[model samples]
Target: MTALPQMILTPLARYGWATHDAVDRDEGAVLRELGRIGEMLGARIAGRAGAIEETIRPQASDDAHPRSLSAQFGLNALPFHAELSHRPRPCRYLLLGCLNPGSSGAATMLLDWRTLDFTADELRLLESAPVLVRTGRRSFYSTLLSPDHAFLRYDPGCLEAVDARGRCALDLVRRRLGSGLSEVHHWRRGDILVIDNWRTLHGRAPSRPSSGRRLARMLIDA
Candidate 1:
């Protein structure tokens, strides 16, 4: 009998995705590995990379996904949304590494726009629209549009909308919640998953304490 080909999961045709086995216990090693991968992938996809480093810790890093937004100011959740960082320079690649893997309910969820339900216009808006994102008394301009990326911050204070280019992306995302695009996977120790910020969104489910801990290192290639 012939053996099957190794089932390697690539991010997508238009995007790049990858996962690496991890073994470092120190935060610095995790960050360094993440940066190395980001640099390599960013050079291939985005042609260049900005700065890559460990996200500064915030106050609400313990709550599930959105609730943790305050403390995880620059970190992203599983199965959540993404886009570019600055204007006209969408983030083309993203990399996340699992330093510690929690047991049970701490799975990361993912959603692909093509799998979500939306009208042609909604789709276009998500690809090229601007969003008004509020981080606090300080608000930064961003959108779901091309070349625009955002760190999924958990600041209820943080909100986003297209300045004037479009307004339906978020609306459609909310409306399409039940389309079954949701994907969930647990990251084991030494595991890494890289995603195309433009084509995928990720978030996480709640988790209870276990023998192992959960520390994820994340970065972007723009």
Candidate 2:
């Protein structure tokens, strides 16, 4: 198995993400390893956290998860975005444990928001831009960037720009992808990734079609 030589926790604080290889590919064991990491971080499983199975190739069209990145983009590379940005407080940490290594090049992609090279004007406009965030159960308004320049609220599918500046901010970000410190990690059975979802934007890269790619997902709060 491809395990990290040093402690996995080091990278989390440094790069906003880290990965560890488990002893087995079994879902139960992988999940246990993830839970252990959460404990070490003084975090707890999120209220809505649970397992998720990811397939690179569509199978029978998953209506249940019609809005999922895989369901919409298939095996193609997905755009970068923060998870559950529509929520009042987006998920803090995202854990993904691999149960199967489907194929090569279909790695998980990460980009730190701090690396975005935006001009002063662009940053100001985005920080003041109002956005309409809506989900089936609720709707609210918030800025694309926090006043303190901390959390970036972004989710292409749910966040709608409410003004011209908001629209411009969205467009500028779309063009700025792949310009920062981007990292891609190919999945291997027994590999588990811990992402500081709040500080990082993540998506998947293009890969060969395969339904064998499976990942169990969980959310954590510190």
Candidate 3:
């Protein structure tokens, strides 16, 4: 498989995110563009099996869950973290496009691991620390920062276990990577954002009571 062009890969590695405004807003055209990009990156665009592709919006039931938007801060919603971070072969990228920006407040935020300002000690701690993550009924262990590529597999939402040092390291990372280091993207119709899921953390802003936000999302893997 061919690798992504350096022109695209460079910014993705350095910033962890990129955006493009589409002149052709038709769903078919947008999808074709996405497929072209995915092919160049040697990735296949995927969605949840058995699910239909459509505009995504917040649900009232999402509020009932502690992890939902209603429970999170109005301005800064908790990030999705790494849903597939712990997997041996995790999703490599995420693509989200706005069909409607919505009258209700909703924006996407991204944090680049490369941009985090970590002290030498904190970095050392993160490199060596282990953490437990739980998804559904399954549990597994992984380091916050991988030794090989410094890849991060942190999901504050799914964190199940951590020791004192690990906890401290996580706290420091969260504190530093929060709103301060995040880049907020206010959606506009036809705006598409591509993210390096392995190297960045992403979240959404809280939606208003009657938000009209609609987005189409796809995961990509090589």
Candidate 4:
């Protein structure tokens, strides 16, 4: 049997992401490679309901507060947050690739949790405070810091809607994860990015309206 390509696990652990460039353009080949890598990581491909979402600009709507297709489809913009925050089984890893690079604004931004610098008081506060996350009709509560591993499960926009304490915590986290440490990735054809969802927050920059950018996304669970 042919040997599978070895997975690169270091960058994702240390920096919260591992990027692979010039991936095979064939979709079937790419999926197979991703599946193999996912298996090596002891993670299964996430199911359809929460996996393989396509982020694209929407057609113009006449509503007073016109929302972009991304927002309409529940795809989040540049807010610092973990994916599937409201779910019992949040994705352990996220795989994102560019299918079509739009004419404007579809860059993805990532923040490494390891790089965030918080004061002792702020850390204590984050560890103690509970954040309420609500998506559509579903709702749940979680702390920013995991009691066991101190991993973060943050979604600032959700917190901003719920209460003052949560908002303050979000602000503190945002301040710590300033522009300096945040990494912005402009997608090219055949590029794939794997992120450790529990250790990183991912979002996108505002894309131009009707720009044809399309991204293929998948989630994995360990």
Top TM-score model: 2
How far residue 199's Cα lies from its native spot in candidate 3, in Å, is 2.3
lDDT tens readout by residue for model 3, 59-122: 5544444543334443345464743564544578877778778896588878877677777777
The candidate maximizing lDDT is 2
Model 3 TM-score (2 dp): 0.80
- lDDT string, candidate 2, 1-222, tens digits: 133335675788798888888887787898788667666654554332243323223223343255555556666677788876867777678877887767553678898887787788888987888888866568888877878776777777677888887798888777787566699888888898888887889987776545566777766665
Task: In angstroms, give how far residue 168 of model 3 lies from its true place.
Answer: 1.4
State the lDDT of candidate 4 residue by residue for 1-222, as single tens digits. Answer: 234243456677668888875457765655566555656655555442544444333233342112222334333355667776656556788877666777874688898776776767877777767677655566677667776644677655444334677667777777776653678888876677888898888877765565787666677776
TM-score of each: 0.61, 0.83, 0.80, 0.78
Can you write out model 1's per-residue Cα lDDT over 99-159, one digit (the tens) per residue?
Answer: 6664553677776655655566765566666566653444455555444323221112234
Backbone collision tally, model 4: 1
TM-score of 2: 0.83
Q: Using TM-score as the measure, what is the rank order of every candidate, best first?
A: 2, 3, 4, 1
Shift of residue 43 alpha carbon in model 1, Å: 6.8
TM-score of 4: 0.78
Question: Against the unseen true structure, what C-alpha lDDT does each candidate score?
Answer: 0.50, 0.72, 0.68, 0.65
Off by over 4 Å in 2: 1-6, 42-64, 207-210
